[model samples]
Target: MSAVEAAPRVEGRSNRGTATWMVVPALVLLIGFFALPYLTIITMSLREASTRAVYGEGFTLAHYTTALGDFYIWGILGRTLLIGATVTVISLLLGYPVAYHLAKSRSRWTSLLYIFVLSPLLVGLVVRTFAWMIILSNNGVANQALKATGLIDFPLQLMNNSLGVTIALTHVFLPFIILPLLGNLQAISPDLAMASRSLGASRMRTFWKVTLPLSMPGIQAGTILVFVLSISAYVTPAMLGGTGGRTMSVLVVQYLVDNFRWPAGAALAIIMAAVAVIFVGLYLRLTARAMRRLP
Candidate 1:
């Protein structure tokens, strides 16, 4: 080979070596932590449930059969899904404007605005759930305000139900949706909106036809994130849901820890994982069609 060609090959090899070295740590962590633990969970889920042994003695499909056949478990799954969908919708509705404002903002206080958006996440989740409990209680601030305004005579049953769970979850995951959406919105060129407006379209119409379509990617990502997180959440549901709003995550914890049914818990976990995967995959496919021709 000529000297010049040999030198390029040598440099390419060095670059690939450096890239491989950089990827090793992340690869190791994924295999050791994420992949192995997930495989262990799947293995445990396939085993029989037993009180005598933590993970059970032999493999059986009883756990899956029992869980799937139980009407009560199905009820909890439905409620969990409903809460997740509600929270995702509410969060998107509230988050989009905030994200849009943040993306278009040139104010010096933009940093402060971002902190305000993220302030709820900075607090411990347990603490936030407790705060919701206080506010949603019978004589809590909401009821008291309603009474003061002559809206009602009796205290409302706000906590220990799906409504309370939905409200709290929406508040908790709102920032998550907003951040990704803000990043997506910022990436869209402003000139596209400007050009639409220059063509005699109203600002509202321009945004409706131009900005919203372009922001679908952000919407898809944010909704999926909120949906997954809200469905899998345990603390807020356990605290506010009480008996009426137990989700799959809470049920899994009850079986695994409180009830000493690891195999059952693992089965429930796997079921949830499968459903999440299917739902997210379907979501991606639908959104993919819309985003195929992004300019």
Candidate 2:
């Protein structure tokens, strides 16, 4: 090679080496904290149960077998999945319009609107779940308001049920979807939307054809985040979910902490995680098909 060309190649090699060095620390942390812990949990899940100890001498798949074959466990798993799907759909529907408005607005209400989006995240999750408990209790604010408005003759059963858990979870995770979506919307060039209008497309039609397609990345990211969070949530479900609302997270905690069955709990957690991975994979594929190719 010529001296000039050889110099550029040597520089490129040095740059690549530097980049690899920069990435090493992150890879170490991920493997140490994230990957290793997950591997331990997977190992725990395969361990045999013992009456005298947390695990027996040899490993077995009995935990998985017992969990999957239990019809009662399957029922809770189904309910958990249903709640996750419901929360994802609701958050997307509600978050999109708010995100879109915040992205485009220049008015005085913009700051006030931004506060609403951030307010939920300001409070701690446990504290917020407690607040929901008060609001959702039989004679609490929501039921009292309903009674005052003659919407009902008596206080409705709100807390200690799936409905209450769902409502609280939706509020808690709403901000997660909006923030990602707002970023995505703001990143979109106004020119693309404007050009669509310049070609005589109406505002609504322009959004559907141009803006929405471009924002699919945000939609995909936000929905996946919300869905995963909802499924893995423990606090809200434990606080609001009575027997009827108890989810897999709550059940897993019972096994690990209350029951002291670490192997069983680990198995359940692995099952839940495996199911989440499968669903997320399929969801990504579906969303990928709809995503517009970007330059």
TM-score of each: 0.96, 0.95
lDDT of each: 0.92, 0.93
| 1-295: candidate 1 lDDT, tens digit per residue | 8998799899999999999999999999999999999999989989877667776678998889999999998999999999998999999999999999999999999999999999989999999999999899999999999999999999998989999999999999999899999999999999999999899999999888899989998999999999999999999999999898889999999998999888889999999888888888988898898788665
- In candidate 1 the C-alpha lDDT for residue 77 amounts to 90
Residue pairs with clashing backbones, model 2: none
Residue lDDT tens for model 2, 85-171 = 999999999999999999999999899999989899999999999899889999799998999999999888898878898999999
Model 1 spans with C-alpha error above 4 angstroms = 293-295
Which lDDT value does model 2 have at 283?
96
Every model: Cα RMSD to truth: 1.4, 1.8
10 residues in a row with least lDDT, candidate 2: 286-295
lDDT of 2 at 209: 89
